[model samples]
Target: MKQLKFNIDSKIKQLFQYEETKNIFDTYLPGMRSRLESQKGVSSFSLRKVISYSGGAISESAIEKIDQALQNVIVYVDDTEITEYTKQQPLTTASAEMKAEGMYTSIRPGKVWRDTEGKRIQTHGGALYYEDGIYYWYGENKDRTDGNCTVWTWGIRVYRSKDLYNWEDLGLMIEPILDNPNSGLYPEKHVDRPHILKCEKTGKYVCWIKQSGEEACFLILEAECFTGPYQIVKENYRPFDWEVGDFDLIKTEDKKAYLFMDVNHNGIYGFELSDDYQKAEKEISRQYENLHPPFCREAVALFERNKKKYMLTSGMTGYIPNKSDAAYSDSWTEPFQSIGNPHPEDESHSSFNSQISQVFQVPGKKDLYIAIADRWVPDYPIDKRRADLIMRSVASHYEPEKYPMTEEEKREIMDRPMLEDVNTSKADYVWLPLRFEDEKVYIDWSDEWRIEDYE
Candidate 1:
């Protein structure tokens, strides 16, 4: 973590290295920000000489004062050396002392997590399913060069782990249906919130994804093996009559599986899964139904603690992180009572600046639960205030008049080609330990953590 020394003779352009040095120039050369258009030529000159070119705008005394201040400034930088904020680099997985090979010692949230092959892991918005002694991680694969757009579905990316930290890339278990344009897996379709359930009765694995495209519904797929050419069990199937966004699937203690989903932008509901785990059995209960667009929810994540069912839902802000709501019920099929935002002081502002994806209990730990969230579009400019985001797709659905839009206007919003693409390859994942103090779930911001830390 060595920082570069602030060299006085270095070009003025290099002053963008850190805030301390940059502030020195900003304070001394008041008009320096106005000359940003000519930064390239200005960068060619040393800081000591830039004063001469400033045409009386900057004085020699100001430069010397800047020099005095920069002498104590060390430029914190990244390997990329790009003019951006400092990024956390993943810890080396090569430590032989690790109990599991390729095991990462800490869960570095909001950091670049490289896989065994020294490539970024693409798993996101997916749950950890534990079977036998191994845990399988499944999520959308954003590693595709298909323009780095999330709307295109590559497949359900899969990885396996003996320890939660060390993961082996298993590639795409469910390949995209590239041949059919009407297929939910088409390049234009946005597949999100993938969840896998293992049915012991049938001895098969069920993979379902919330796909929004030609058909806005859950695309159900099943496979005989975990790593598979998962064939479609159902296509364009809407468990309810609405445009669904994100969902979560959980198999309960009674050998029954329940589906918790965002019923369009209206409310959050729970449905029972059929015996084969291929389709939704029936609508069991709906909560947050009374909430209008202002308080509407999406990205439903369900889990059980001490036989009490808990649910987490994020506000309906597309790609932008929002405050997450926590609720609990006596049964998975029952309506949950709102527990409000469960994040602690630092994270209470905006769910640790990450949206809830899923909350899962660590293997072999009865009470230890982990709240997995995605810092989606991490660098996208937005805040916790939902009132400020009128251009968001969900906002149009909730209130068409205040944010009026024609049919074509609505379709053209998220179109990558029609608009400037916000490539999501740089998106980050936020994994925090969820502490249940009595009935409340709290997530404190942790820059880096390990599962063993809980044990």
Candidate 2:
């Protein structure tokens, strides 16, 4: 056997750091080679190595070490040795081929959550429960190999995180129950928008999910654990007969619980949940016209700021971006004023480029709540759809006598942090500051932001 000497150039060294380049080495080239070998049905296959370019013009000693690395992979066949550099070129080429076919989109653009390694978080129209000292995140496991977001075909997945960044998969919280009669026509009956709460008096964990349909139903189910082996509790369990929109629950200081939703599909609506949350009391409907958008609003979050009440609603765009509109009032009911889209310029704000999957009011942080979103990447590889969860802080700074938002403020709000350009690639999480005025929290997206020290 003859030894082959092969060298590498600096250009190839840098390309190795890129996933797109390495994915070529890892996934595509091997798949192609495997398929080709199987079709041949042969024990060994050899191809002619016709070199088009070869240069030993080493300008640096570092290049020489790189060359030695390449030489180790060189092969000699029929007295013709293939360079190590040449062998790597095929893998690089294969990666390009697979990427051009959209194989790495799913794995790329991972979510940003401040200080957390977030590969397992997918809060898709899901819910969060603040339990004990930890926050439990539960949502649809769209991180599977299905690659489809149909009304059916997915189940709830759960994870627990202490600081809302690093997550440990607790397995599927809600499994697909095909045999259940109320589970709709197919096992794939979509389970969207999950919100969890702990009953103040009973200390029970409750989750509310929005079922799929033209006229949607919001089902409030209770479980013993935040990541539930959830069982459907009757009574207030079914709101199928009513047209319910994005619904969220808020507990008053008095230990009374209230459920809020988009009423008439135009504005905020509220109803008191029974002590057991089995059902909302009949004739308990209250509407607020001015607090939310009259055109289109979904994904609602209820927050209290400076002793005032505010309701946040996001526009409906379904995996596409859209503007977010909010409103607030002293009372949960009427006289609510609409605070127009907070991030009109954010390409991902509308529809959140996904949707307001869940709003987690930090059980640990005082006067702090985090709005959770899923950044949908429909073009991901491996039949898996990926979503990025974003957190923004809402604050209140307003004089009730004055309008909730001024014209100048509205213009400035959307202009900053261009969503298309906002760097989420390396950002673990983002904190958008909001002000509380008159009782409601107003969220304004900020690129340059800082949190004040409480101590």
TM per candidate comes to 0.70, 0.56
Error of 2 at 177 (Å): 0.9
* Model 1: per-residue Cα lDDT at residue 18: 59
Off by over 4 Å in 2: 1-118, 145-153, 180-187, 235-240, 263-266, 282-294, 333-335, 344-354, 363-367, 377-433, 437-440, 444-455
Q: How many angstroms is residue 409 displaced in model 2 relative to the true structure, after the best TM-score fit?
A: 31
* Residue pairs with clashing backbones, model 1: none
The top-ranked prediction according to lDDT is 1
Error of 1 at 436 (Å): 1.0
- lDDT score for residue 225 of model 2: 63
At residue 155, give the lDDT of candidate 2.
62
Alpha carbon lDDT at 150, candidate 1: 28
Writing each residue's lDDT as its tens digit, candidate 2 over 1-455 gives 54433333323222233344334333323443343323221111111110101122323463444445454554334422321211211211123223222111111222333113224344455666766787677766444312211223246777776645455677677765544535632334445666676786677777777665443666556777667777776422444255766778777777677777765466556778777665667434454443422235667777776656766676543333345666767775445577665544454434334345444555545655556555543322111111111111011122223334444443333223321222222222223434444443555454443223211
For residue 77, give model 2's deviation from the true position in Å.
Answer: 53
